[model samples]
Target chain A: MDTNDYIVQVQDLYYRYDKENVLENINLSIKKGSFLAIVGPNGSGKSTLLKLMLGLIKPQQGLIRLFGQDINKFKEQHKIGFVSQKANSFNTGFPATVFEVVASGLTKKLGLFNFLRKTDHVKIKQAIESVGMGKFLDRNIGELSGGQQQRVFIARALVSEPELLILDEPTVGVDVQNVNSFYGMLETLNKEKGITLLLVTHDIGTISEKVTNVACLNKNMHFHGSAEEFEQLKINDVSEIYGHDVHVLTHDHHHHGGGHLHD
Target chain B: MISGLLQYEFLQNAFLTGMIIGVIAPLLGVFIVVRRLSLIADALSHVTLAGIAASLLLEKKFMIFSGLNPLYMGMAFSVGGSLFIEKLRTVYKHYQELAIPIILSGGIGLGVIFISLADGFNTDLFSYLFGSVSAVSRADLWTILIISILVIALVVLLYKELFLLSFDEEYARATGIAAKTLHFIFIIMVALVIAASMRIVGILLVSSLMTLPVAASIRFAKGFKQTIFFSILFGEVSVLGGLFLSYYLDLAPGGTIVMIAVLILVLAIWLKKRAATRSI
Candidate 1:
């Protein structure tokens, strides 16, 4: 397989939190430059899979490869940018500016003992501008709206110019009306920058039109196919995985990520 | 006060030492306050008391250890306390904040024992507990100057790493930043600042210098850099003002400095509330 074909490939991955298996024999691949959304119910192991892929938690049995290198040995962590669910949970009283927060993304690239140079400042400026937060560079992060703060976080992850971007419920604190525009910016980043975007979200209805592929995960990989094929999934099939009725594309108006819109 | 610098060596010593510490205490305090580890400074200062009391006792018991400054031993104990706090944090992984009280009580317990063994608070110990402006020696000033240079250098070199670690530990670790090592160095810096500050601020009041200005700065400052700047500014005002007042009034330097910092905090909160209401 080509190096650019699969940015992340997990084979026979198994992880156990306490006793029972949280993720069992899960095999998934994120194609390079493709926008993939991993959709699942609350306890469907979507986060565990993301963690396994991110090398945060070690798997008991299996292999995870990133950019053709094993995740444990992968030294180019700068190539994989992550925007976590806790992005909104940051201290509202933190006294960092947008520029300072975004400048932190270059920590991996800048290495230790190296201060942020003028060139790094340009990159930081470009990232804040990319997220359309140029005007708020000097403003405290706590001063921005929830949506604006999320944009600064996205800009923080994007400052290093990673090849793959992963986000865990990037729309949690974001407003209902602006979710689409938020994702529209992400799609632009994918198409314009050739960045592979992998998002773990419950906004199946809002994100279906923008994503190139969908991976429905529940303990194991239930479905990994094109977005068009995923939309064609039977309601009962997803209901079985969630252990309840799951109505997909039912015009779910709920703005939050923890929404369980089912019959 | 200005004329005191020209006339007396002890006045010059305390004045110069206070100026340098004013910059570093709150500079490092910004990280400590934001990380919610302000209590660690308190805990470390108490441990520094143990070292001071032990050294003072040793100076009385042993002729060879005489003439040595207790602040040196205090700095060592503070650094040791920092490492122990880090270890306890790792051990109790779930209840990380428990590390503070665990180390804090242990420091006090040890401190009390040493104080008792030394036959309670002597004049020297009393001065250490509540800073003495007239007692600051030339050697103490030089020692503080060197420690301040080291603390400032380490903070400048690792500012970005420390900031990221303070803001988000998980992200810093995910990006392959040595969170443990960086945190280790950070606490050591905190320890040094606490130990260095104890001479002028006293062990009991040292944490105020490390936290009060930071608390005030966070109320109205817009960014981390601005917060740091304001923290240092507040620290300087408190130190200088307190030093001047102590010289004329025969008051304890530590008590005076901390009182001024508390005043700034109150003023900052009042001004911020006023600003918020005006905007609304």
Candidate 2:
């Protein structure tokens, strides 16, 4: 494959915290415009892997590349947008409007001492509208529902116009009703906007259909293949990754006429 | 009072320094409150007191140190305390808040020892502790003015990065905002502001000046900018009003200023309650 085709390439990545080894010898590559879901059980080091890829933490050994450049040398951070776990990332009582939150996405790209231009305002509005939050632009972020806040965060990430969007448990606190629509928006961003998506989530049931590829991770990468291949994976294989006896069940929802995986 | 401002240099010095601190204290206070580091201000203020006490002790012991302004010493200790607090927080990550009380206690303990060594509180120490309208010298005003300018410039230069870090530190770091560097810069700025503010608000009540207006502004401000605007507005009102009241009533300016800030905070809470009932 051409180096330009892959947005993220990790070779033999390893991470340890104190004495426990979180991840070991992980090799993965994410192609542009593809939606990849990294799913695993608790303590699976999904977040750790995401942080390593984002350069929040360095790997003890191995090489990771973003846009064909070494991770350490990757300077175009604005090309990749990131949203951490929803519940822990922000203060609920923080006094910030949706528009302000979205506009902050451009802060790093614009650099210090430079004020936002009129074009930046247009871009901010466009990002908020893209997340279906145009009406709430002037509203305080704290007043919004959990799902709406997540959307605003997505708008914040999108405001930078990143080619690759990575989210960690984006729907952690979202209501069940809103989780489906949230995934729907992610799918739209993946397909329509042509942005590459890398999400770490435990919502394997709802997002399986929306994602193009799945990586079952537990300390090491257990499986990495197409979504169809993931769907046909044996229960024992998934159980082995989970380190427990687990059952995989697929149910077809009559209302949406879509298949969902359940554990 | 208006005529008195022109007649006396001390009044001019006090008023000018108070006005400059009015803008900076709550401006940085907005970040401190949002980041839930309000207690750090109190800890640093106590540490500054230790420095002031030490300076007074040295002045008493030696003629060469007699003319030196204690504000410089106070600022040094405040900055040192801020760095130490950061170190302790990193050491005890699980119980990070333990750093504040430890530093606060250590500061007070050292201050007590220094005060005792100087043969107890004198007229100069009293002014540093409670603030005197006539006590701010021309040199103190200039020092405060310079510090204020530097603090404001740093804030303006790093506003966006500071906002990101205060709002979501992990995300800020992930976006390559250099959290550690910005944090050190921020704490140092906080130290400088606390020291500059001590002349008007006094070491004992400086943290109140920094935080009280923010407490009131969070009641109704719609956005971060609005919160900052309202915090500065309240800060100015408190300082200006407190100065005038102290002048007429012959009261300690620190106590007067903090009382005014408390009154504003109470009024804000009441107003917010009333608005909620009306909306319902």
Using TM-score as the measure, the top candidate is 2
Query: Residues A1-263, candidate 2, lDDT per residue (tens digit)?
Result: 89999999999988989977999889999999999999987688999999899998888899999999999999999999998887877899999889888888988999878888999999999999999998998898999998999999989899889999999989878876677788999999999999999999866777778899999888988889899998786666677766665555555464332333334
Listing candidates in order, what is each one's chain A TM-score?
A: 0.93, 0.93
Q: Scored by Cα lDDT, where does model 2 land?
A: 0.90
Name the regions of candidate 2 deviating beyond 4 angstroms.
Answer: A234-237, A240-243, A249-263
**Predicted structure with the largest DockQ when compared to the true one:** 2
- Stretch of 10 with least lDDT, candidate 2 chain B: B121-130
> Candidate 1 has which clashing residue pairs, if any?
none
Q: DockQ score of candidate 2? A: 0.84
**lDDT tens digits, residue span B234-261, model 1:** 9999999999988789888999999999
True contacts kept of each: 0.79, 0.87
